[model samples]
Target: MLQQETALQKLWSWLFENKVMLLFLLICVGGVAVSGNSASFVIENVAIRFGRNAFTVMSLLIPVLAGLGLNFSIVIGAVAAQMGLFFAVDWGFNGVMGMLIAFLIATPLAMLFGFGVGRLFNKMKGSEMIAGLILGYFADGLYQLFFLYILGGVLPVKTESLIIPGGIGIKNTIDLTGNMKYALDEVKLVDIVLIFFIIIAVISVFRIIIKLKNKEQSPLKDLIILLLAAAVYALTYVPAVESMLMTSKLSLLNVFLIIAVVGIAYAIWKIISNKLNPDPKFKAIRYITIIVAIVLLYALTYIPELEKILMNSKVSALPLALIAGLSLFNAAFLSTRIGQNMRTVGQSRVIANASGINVDRVRVLAMIISTVLASWGQLIYLQNLGTFATYGAHLQVGQFAIAALLIGGASVSKATNKQAITGVILFHTLFIVAPEAGKVLFNNAMLGEYFRVFVSYGVIALALAMHAWQRKKKPSLELPA
Candidate 1:
């Protein structure tokens, strides 16, 4: 009976912890059903939306880690990206070169904007979130002033297409169709793979050097993992495998099979590693759960309708790689000294300061990093979108990204890479299906649009409220006399 009670408690805890994710998952499933959209259509739309928005959403993570809550000031970073794009277009830079130049221009400008925002946040401290929101509005005004009064009026631009009739202000919309459309997305898959290999090799060499310098044991495990991964990648070179992969769209079942194979391999590795060095903390239940999930996913691929949807979805290779890279970076950053400082500062400024860490500096660094990332994310979004909305493109960036993060069960004090990725998928899935669902149920597509917008704002508000309530309920530390 005691054991049963403990098991029940554990189940309850898991449910409570994952309540938001589970709810969103259910809503997405229900929305898809009600919308009556074909699975293929939804899958295709979600794949495109994910490529466009994932990076911007992930950009919010660092500020949250530093206890700055949602960085609404990411709009400022978006502005910097637009400015770079403007220059890139005005100079007649096109294709991949244009995108690269825009990135180069955006980076320093974003850094500058991020630095200023960081300083302001340090002063605002407890109210950094609100301060950032207001700063975005404030920055927008300056942004308009520069583009309207200064860009063409004070500083002439060569591009007539970008200038208004009176030539005083820049146009409200800039077409990137010829200049930078599909710049990143059109990158050859082979180039991306080659770059990935080079990056891995570089990192491996660096790690070996560090190990040697420290007189530590050789990183045999790391080398083994790298070799194993390379071996798997090499299988793609087989004529049959290569021909299949070269197709415009891959079968959904194949994708699931690939993932299942990787998961099974990892699970086997864990079992062997556990045998060699037993860990009390290791739980076989996790592997069991993962295997179950893989099985379910694989089973879904066997369903005809689901299979069609999966096969029909075409993902952009470079953008997907970038998203994965950013996720990996988030995980890697958290293990670094600076990331630890951000975490420490986030937990309690008083404690962080007391521990001789410069809390203000850490917070500033976090904002700077977040802002710079937001700039790059905006670049990715615009390049994929193939058009630049000079004035309106960035307006909803912060709100939507923050909402997505919050919807994924992230709070003001805590978030993770997994939560951010999951939130993007769920939030965007709802975004894609909600309007159709609304139209189906209520005969009004607008209603669905309103509902999704409401969900975006509502989720953020709910997270904030929950955060405040939790703080109030938390017990304060009391020193004994």
Candidate 2:
């Protein structure tokens, strides 16, 4: 009996240690097994579907890192992305050009809205997440007013097709396939841009590891890392590399390979140069060169493609995922940082004041950022669906983003980029497949939608419960007498 109990304890300890990987593996296996005979088809279909969804999921990364609690305001970015799509479609902007133009158009709106949300979250402090969540709901009402009523009645939307048959209101749904459909995926421009972002993330991780390796060392390693990063950017953007990318299959794998080679070469070059002479002034020049090179390369690659596509495609209600992802990331990160500061102020405004951090500034920033992310999120969502359902479209965004984040393993007080991505993938996978999974077993597709909703909400509840349980487990030491 004693031996059995000891073995059971050991098993429990092992499971706890490998919990995240174990859970992820379980989800993958369970998802596949549920597909039964069509599992391969189902897996591939879902994975491709995931690519369609990845941009939006990635949008939540910055906000989570900044501690903003899922940026419920991502709807704002979505909405702004929609406006760009709407105009692009109206003007007959096709494919890659439309995507780029739409992205450019959405940027200003995302910044404005994100700033507003950041301010609001800053005011709420400890309740930033909940505050942002509610704010998203309020913004939805405003979004509906603009999208459903104002645009057709007073705003003079140029395209007749966008307005309703009544001629005084917008339609319940607008088809956007003609303008901005699959712009990002279809555009075969510099594969390095995609790889650049991924490599930046990798280099970021490597820098962290290096920091841990030599905490006692001088700040020289940072300069080396920065120089390497810049070199990678410069090498990847060299005009000659663009031709090579053009010949290769325009796939994510190809993009990744190019980025890996560029990063390796850049790292080696920087390491050798730093060993030869470590000057801060030279380091700054390297940084500037990398930034300029990347900018020039991106412009050289996408500008022409965008110009050509802007002349062709037209989609009214399109999903501008590419643009929204970038905007939301910035907004979420800013708001999260401001909100964290606000929490510190809330814990003791006097101490925070003494430290010279302006509480009001933090609050304002939080509000702005949150609002911007929300705006972009709405835009991306509307464009992707290719239509808007009057009252129903924006209604679920706050709940969905929040629910998705929590489902992915986020909490009210803390979250991470990995959690946001993992949650969205799993949540979306379940969302995409649940209906079919249900139909196969129960012969009813509606059951699948209900199952998805139930699971989404259930996941949030589970995360909250787990967080509370974890908090309870922390032993409190009595104050010394």
Candidate 3:
């Protein structure tokens, strides 16, 4: 019975890990049945509407990577994007040109915002997650001030369409239809731009890290890992009787990224492997296996049916870049030697000083990274949404993003990309279906809204309480031991 229970526990953990996929499946089935009366319309409408939402959802993955929590302040990025849109409107840069210009403008703003937020977070140290959540609220107030009081009055907001009726500030919502709608719809194919950029970025970063580590660390094991990964990517990109173009074209940039990543990994592996005297043959097997695994990884994307369903969908390249970039930020915070130093400084400046790490410098860098990711995420999210919420736009952004992440199973001290993605999917799915589901089952859509609010708050409370409880229990457990 104990063994059975243990097995069940393991199964439960696995389920938790894959909760998003499970929830997605359940929602699809239940959604279909619930709306079966108009299944076709529901499918067509929901897919189109939600597809527009994918980029924002994907944006949440970045701060999670950077170990900055869920980045509820990503709305800062959105605000930056909105500022761009506003400017584009002023300049009469219509359509794609306007959208492109907005994107360009948002980039610097995002970076600036990210740098500031990152700095603040470093100061807060252990409390970065909660700090970020609160920061979102503060930023929202600023956003509202700009949108409400400044834009039309102090700043030049020329277009009546964008301005409010009284003419002091911008309208509650700007009509994005003619301005920036589907600007990149053509030149930015879901395939070439989005996938290519992601693959290239991921591969290059991974390779560079591995290579750098190899120079100072171990070699054979790292080499094996790189080779195996290369094999996987190579295999996936290989053309059959059909042309290579027919296959998933691995972009040159992606190839570069992959090389950089493998290089870095190799360097790291060699260093680690050298510290432990393992059999030389074990090292050889390891490299072979590493190459094979990477090859397999890239190859996995080649399945015709799966690729058709997943890869064929058009997505923006910007979000992918943001995710990759933010993840590196998180990686820096979490696992890196520098990251450990940051934590040390956060815990005790005196001790960090004693340990010989530059606490002040580390703190600054941490802030810069966090804020930059925040800025970028906000931009991606706003662009993806193609609209702004005005006073309430950035208000609960930090809260909701943090709540969603925790609900999806991240604790304050530890979060991962997987958790952020899962949380966003589940949280958004609930956002979509709950009201309707409530209306269908309970007779009032508002009930679903209430349920959502309850769950959102409940998750945050639960996560915080859990953290406190664990902290309290640690002393007791250690005392007995």
Candidate 4:
């Protein structure tokens, strides 16, 4: 009976820990079913939405790490990107060049905006989240003022398309068709692969040199990884492979197979390396779990409906690659010195200060990095969308991103790249199907739209409430009188 009670408690803990994710998963499944959308259609929409919004969502991570909850001020970064886009379009730049110019223009402006936000956050230390939320609104007002009065009115601007009828403010909407539409998405997958290969090669070589300089063990593992990467890059040049990549879309089955192969290869490499090195950190259970997951995924592909969807659904490669790169960046950043400092400060500003760390500077740096990334993320979002809503594009960015992050099981004091990516997938999946699900269930599409919007805000509020409740429940350190 004691053992049974312990087991039940453990199960309860597990359920409590994963309640949000499980709830979202159930909703996604039910919504997809009720929406009456084909599996392929849902997958396609989810993939596209993921590509469009994942980066912007990711831009919230750094500030969260620095103890600034949610970084709602990232909307300022979005506004800066829009400003850059406006000037880029006004200057007659097009294609990738326009995107590049916009990025260059936005980077400095975002840095400036981020600095101010950081200073403000520092002043309002414990209340950074609320401060950021208010800051976003304040920034939006300034953004409107600039676009409405400063652009064509105070400044000399002859761009007819951008100017309003009264010729005082910028137009409410700016079309990016022919200019920067699909600019990054249109990049050849082969080129992206080659660039990734080269970066990996360079990093590998650098690490190998450092190892040799220190007279440490041979970098056999690095060499093997580089070789594997090179082989993958080489396959891209094969006529059949190249043709498949050049096509606008790729089969989800092929994509899944590729992922499975990569996973298997990694497992094999880990096993071999473990046998050779006998690392104490190796976990048999973890590998077993991974192997089981891979097998289950492959088995699911055999189901007739799932198989049809997997074979029929296609996804673009470049945007996915970009998202993967950003995810990697987030992971790698945490291993660096600044990331360590940010983590230290996040855990305890007093301790961090006692450790000789400049908490304010670190927080400022975090905001700058987040703000710049947010600017770039907004650019990616707009280019794919091919339309810039001058006055409104940046409005919901902070709220929606924060909501997604919170929905993915992240909290005020802790977040991870995995959580961010999971949140993007789950949150966007709900966004994609919720309206249709609502319509089917309630006979009103507007209800679904309202439901999704509500879920976004509701999730954030729930997470905040939970955080407060947890804090309140924690045992105090004071001794009894």
Candidate 5:
């Protein structure tokens, strides 16, 4: 009884520490369950949303590192991206070249905006969040003025349809028919899958080779697992699975067999290698996980209604590649002296200053980097969307992106790429499923929209309150700036 109680206490403590993640998890599960949507449907949209919003959410990290809270001025970066994109469209530049040009144009603009925001944040140190938020609105007004009145008149826009009828301002809605649509989504699905499988097989083989050098695993068992995985993949050449996947159905059995067989093979190898504990509870839990996973495949696959909703669950290679690049950049950035200085300022400006670091410059650089990333992110997003609302596209970017970050368990003072990616998945899961769930329950999709809106603001509010409460409790440990 005492042991059980101790275990429960540990669980509760972990939940408390990760409450944001836990709450989002619950919301996602509830949304999925109530919506009665197919897993593929939810996953497809979530993956796309991850690509759309992950970079922007990540952009908030540097500003957070500098203790600037959520950089609501990231919208300024979006504004910059839009201006670049506007010109690219006007210049009749299409495909990849247009996107690259947009990025080049947005770079200087984002840096300028970011530098200004950072300087202002330094002046309003303790209230950086509010200042950033207010600055976003102020910047929006300028963006509107530029787009609505200055584009054709001041800036030479040659494209006729891009500008309004009176030839003064750009159009409210820009059709990206010939310009940079799907700029990051041009992928051949089967080729991508082959590449993925090749990478996985190579990694697995390398791991096995290393283990063999150490005499850790049964080579026979590892070989059997490899053969089994290869056989399952060979089924893809059968034309049945290919046709099925090409049509995009929720074939749970197909997915489960591929996963379960691989999992079983690995598990058996582990046991044979003496790597896994053969205890009763451990064995029972492991078998149950396998069983439940396979059972779910059959159950979900048999449901006819679910089949109707399963959409094309294909992954875009470019977005995944870009995400990997950004993650690597973050890791590399954090290993540098500038990164250490950024961290020091985030901890306490006084400490950073005492250590002979230029705190102000570090903060400005952080913001500048964030803004540049955000600008690129917006470009990626617009290309994916294919068309965009010229006047209102970037309006709520900072709010939703920050909300997603906070939902992933980030705070005002600290964040990570892990948190950003996780938050994008969970928040977008809710974003995708909640409306369908709401329509099923209340017959009103608007209710779900309102709920999502409230959630965005509510999360920001909750995070701020928590930050304040922590500050008040640790008054002695107050960050000196």
Candidate 6:
């Protein structure tokens, strides 16, 4: 019986590790059933949403890495972004400049907000999650006060449109139509594909360099590299592939901004950052897998059955570049000195302390980083939406972001970039189909809305419960006896 129980436990652990994939499969089935022939439309929406929400979800990674739980105070970061947008509007900054200026104004403010939140988290320690949630609400009140009264009443305001009719408070909705709407998604597909191709080549070269440094070689890696080279050659000759690549693009300014913020900046940082000393064989395997994927993507473009479904559908705001950058950052950050410290702090604060690791400082830095990322993420989201809700936009920010992370298979104790990405795709796919499904099944779309909210909050609660249960099951480790 004891052996059987131990075997069952191992099975459960394996299943939980792949929980994100399982959840995605279930969501995909429900999506197809509910949307029926409209599945493409649902897919389109998910693609667009991926650009909007993924960054915020990604922000939760650092804090979780440091075992500080989710950073509920990221809502404060969203608020900082909002404040920047407001000021940008007042300055009459339009188009690309408007969004850029907003981000510029928000960065410092977000850093300031993050610093305070980090300090507070350090003080609270074990109660960080509950405290952070409460802190968000408290900050919300101050945010309301600042926008509602302080801006128009005390601070000098130049823009009449930003104020309510009474000229005493900020308006309930600020239109961003004149500038900043779909600002980052305005490029032609040809231009976008050119960028993607460049990315593929760079990634391929980077992998080769890493392998050379490690003095590792694999037959599979050699095979995939050859295939990618073939794909690159094929792409050079294929007009149809070029045409498909131009399907979605942001404006020139948005393009420049994205390249700067999500591309060049990320590249510069990665170059400076130390990589994890992964096993040479593991590193070889990782690069080989990626190279195979590149080869497969190029191959997929030719297969008639999949070409239309995969390449020709035309997703307008996928923000593939930004996604790549964030994924890269998350993956690479894990191998740094700080990243290792985060793991140490996460596993056992006592051990970390004995190892001379400053657990509290690491946790604070994690919160600050999460806060800054969340702020920038909200900026990305609003640019796509082309408008801002003056009062309640940030209200559900923390809840939704947290829910998406948890649904992705992230728990209080563990998460990864892949899990975060998977969760956003599944949760948002479900979000897209649930209303229509609810309408079709129950004759009311509101049922779907409520259900979505319920699922979001429910996922968070379930994750917390599972974490507690796992803790109870895994007895504490004993020191060398």
The candidate maximizing lDDT is: 4
**What lDDT tens digits, residue by residue, belong to model 4 across residues 109-165?**
999999999998999989998888898999999999999999887996767878989
Prediction RMSDs, each to the true structure:
3.8, 11.6, 8.2, 3.8, 8.5, 8.5
lDDT measured at residue 101 in model 2 versus the true structure, 0 to 100: 71
User: What's the lDDT for candidate 2?
Assistant: 0.58
lDDT over C-alpha atoms for residue 450 of model 6: 80
User: Across residues 225-262, which tens digit of lDDT does each residue of candidate 5 receive?
Assistant: 67776776777787876664343122333444455676
lDDT of 1 by residue, 122-237 (tens): 89879988899999999999999999999988898998878989888998889898889888888766556657876777787778778778877887866876686577568678
Q: Please, what is the TM-score per model? A: 0.88, 0.65, 0.63, 0.88, 0.73, 0.76
lDDT at 481, model 5: 46
Pairs in steric clash, model 4: none
lDDT of 3 by residue, 422-475 (tens): 666556655556556656777777886886676567767766666566556555
* Model 5 TM: 0.73
lDDT (Cα, tens digit) per residue for candidate 6, span 1-481? 1333466666776676655557656865775597563655765677778878898899889888888888888899999999998898898887667877998999899988888888888888789899989999999999999998999899978999788998889989888886777766665556555556666667777777777778767445754865676577568457887655555643323332344444444444443342554343333444445445555545544656444444434434445566667778887887899989999998899999999999878887887788888888898888888889988889889898887887777887788887888888888887777666676777776886786676777777776777676567556321223
Question: Which has the higher lDDT value, candidate number 1 or candidate number 6?
Answer: 1
- The lDDT of model 5 is 0.79
The positional error of residue 14 in candidate 2, measured at the CA in angstroms, is 9.2
Q: Estimate candidate 6's alpha-carbon lDDT, on a 0 to 1 scale.
A: 0.76
Q: lDDT (CA) for every model shown?
A: 0.83, 0.58, 0.58, 0.85, 0.79, 0.76
